[model samples]
Target: MNWYRFSDLAIDDDEISMLRRVHIYVCSSKDLEPESAGGTEIGKMLFHLYRQGVRSELGLIRMVTEGEPPPAAEAE
Candidate 1:
């Protein structure tokens, strides 16, 4: 998938799909704690997407990501 700066403001469907896939892959695992590194990154990305006006369900994403840590800067 392609990546862009937040200022670019050109988010596409593939990028959004990738974000949802990441959230699903991370959130669907029973063994994965919501506070884990992987989970934190998912939370961070979903938050970013919501801020960018792309979201399937804000309530559900927030439920898993609200208290989790943001992703590392390198991920940006």
Candidate 2:
């Protein structure tokens, strides 16, 4: 299960550039209890918004995964 909080560009003159940096925070849990399921639900909701093109770039961001080194260290 995962919990996600999504924030995108707000529709207003003041938020034009300020809102472009959409933020999505996801809390992942392996538990199957009701509470954990709730977190998963939240992640799904954020994904739905991404598919619907809600944000400027749909919350795309740089990600680093286990065992994957940084690009600078990658052999050419």
In TM-score terms, which candidate is top? 1
lDDT of 1 by residue, 1-76 (tens): 9787775766578766756665765576434565778777766867676666664565545555567665446744
- Global lDDT of model 1: 0.63
Q: After TM-score superposition, what is the CA distance of residue 2 in candidate 2 from its true location, in Å? A: 29
- For model 2, give the 10-residue run with minimal summed lDDT: 57-66
- lDDT for each residue of candidate 2 in 1-76, tens digit (9 for 90 to 100): 8554454432455433423232222332222332366555644554456455544432422221224343355566
Indicate the residue-level lDDT of 72 in model 1. 45
Question: By TM-score, how accurate is candidate 2?
Answer: 0.29
Q: Number of clashes in model 2?
A: 1
Off by over 4 Å in 2: 1-35, 56-76
Minimal lDDT window, size 10, model 1: 55-64
Off by over 4 Å in 1: 1-26, 29-31, 58-76
